[model samples]
Target: MAHPALKNAWPIPRRIVQRTRGHGQGFITRLMSPADLGQALKPFVFLDIFDADRAMLQAVERSGGMPIHPHSGVATVTVITQGHARYDDPAIGAGEIAYGGVEWMRAGGGVWHGKEMTAGDVSRMQGFQLWLALPPELENGPAESRYIDAGDMPYAWPAHIIVGKYGDVRSPVPAPDGINYLLVTMRPGESWSYAPPAGHSVGWLALAKGMLDAGSTVSAGEMAIFENGEAPISLEATGSEDAVFVLGSAVPHPHPLHLGHYSVHTSAEALAAGERRIAELGQKLKEAGDRQTASGSVPVFR
Candidate 1:
């Protein structure tokens, strides 16, 4: 017998409605939020795909991966597809992640700290950084972080369940119910299908390598937003190269987004609370020297 969540759920075939090319100097990325298309993909707000080579790596190593920053009222999900990277967080400890690895941080109420992630042993790295808006209750809560290596992630052939459930496998990363995220790689001339769970009407995919043919062509450094429906999406590698991409689907986020300089929340009140908490945490970090400790402490917003 199927669980109540899965029972009576059926796959629908979704169609691509919009396509956008990423923008950047070397490692280009498409900023989806603050755009008209952003309203179509709620819960999931911001997206950036960084494609780095040896030159880029050297540049990042020189300046570090963005100075220490602060965030609240949302969770950030980072997935590495090309090479590897390492992260040292006060609350999450330190770990290295290779291809298919993930770094998940929930800045519930507020949090401040950066310089935790750096290029791995490899000379190059490519990956996606995504932001998911938090619900009201969790908007002003405590912050948390997790670094998951590729092997610990569940997979079946070409598909690795990055979040939510797929087949009998479920991701170890904790997240709210009713969302699914997958990292898929199909061999040349190969094909695949994804059937999202019930109520997950919003669907989208961004390719990191190769190409995908879903009636229309989708290539690297591009994203395809699907029309709302329960339809199972069908995709095939169109070129001689394998296709690597990330797919995300979820029930549309219901509340209007209340945005801050570095935060996102469901309501104005929640956003205010989160910003206040961020200010409070900033002061505490300043009082404690706001520097990495000798013993490697895991800092969290209370």
Candidate 2:
């Protein structure tokens, strides 16, 4: 039997995080907040979409691109759709993240790393970067990293399971809080249904490409937050092009959040400890001659 389609009744207001208003980057990011960053995005904390033309990508590369940076108290999920990203982490493994490939890295205590596009690899380099926050229990757990090749993820139907499970397909990356991430691609006249666990909270959905029809047409770069509802959130492409987007849900862990330089925790003390740990790791890497510059030095949250 086909699972019941999940409906999104309570409308989630759209907040623009990064917009194409700037001259350089051809994409924008929307940071949904007011709800604690970790709780609201349950299992997911931050999301950024990098989409641009080859000229723009080349400009960014010339501008030094993202530098070696540090992160903690969360996991970074990088999904490449158009181009490739070369990533290196002394703590984890290093490799080239190609189109449709996913690099899942846990910055539990802390980790420093860098990512850049290789020369002559001049594709548009479009993709999404999501930050999944760790709950209080595992906020400072062991740090780790994993990569999923384009072929490894499940893309059987119109939807692709990248981080969790959909129907009979499962993701190689284990979700921490019973959460799942699915990328759905719809034909101009087609649609699909998603049956989420009852206990799970209504997750967040972002329209990456094409328009989504559910009483209203949600255009690209917009996001919808689904509250507990009956009907599955449906979509029908309005243009000749196909529609593609990402949806994620998790067992909501509504807890207070403390934002810090390189981590997110329940309290200031925990955040301090996380930073201290990361500093120590940096020192160790330096001593071992394995330290590398990160993409960006600015802390994500605070």
Whole-model lDDT per candidate:
0.80, 0.64
Name the TM-score of candidate 1: 0.90
Per-residue alpha-carbon lDDT of candidate 1 for residues 192-237, written as tens digits (9 for 90 to 100):
8888888999999999899999878999888999999888899999
Regions of model 1 farther than 4 Å from truth: 1-12, 25-28, 34-36, 293-302
Assess every candidate by TM-score: 0.90, 0.79
**List of clashing residue pairs for candidate 1:** 12-231, 12-232, 13-231, 13-232, 90-298, 90-299, 91-298
lDDT digits (tens) for residues 1-302 of candidate 2 = 44445334433333223222112234545344323444555567667776877787677668876665677787878776566766544444456676556877778878775442342265566677788777776678777777667777777577667887766778888657477787777878786556665555556677767877755666777666666433355556667777777777777656666777656676677788788888887776666652333632222211
Top candidate on TM-score is 1
Candidate 2 to truth, TM? 0.79
Question: Candidate 2 vs. truth: CA RMSD?
Answer: 5.9
Best by lDDT: 1
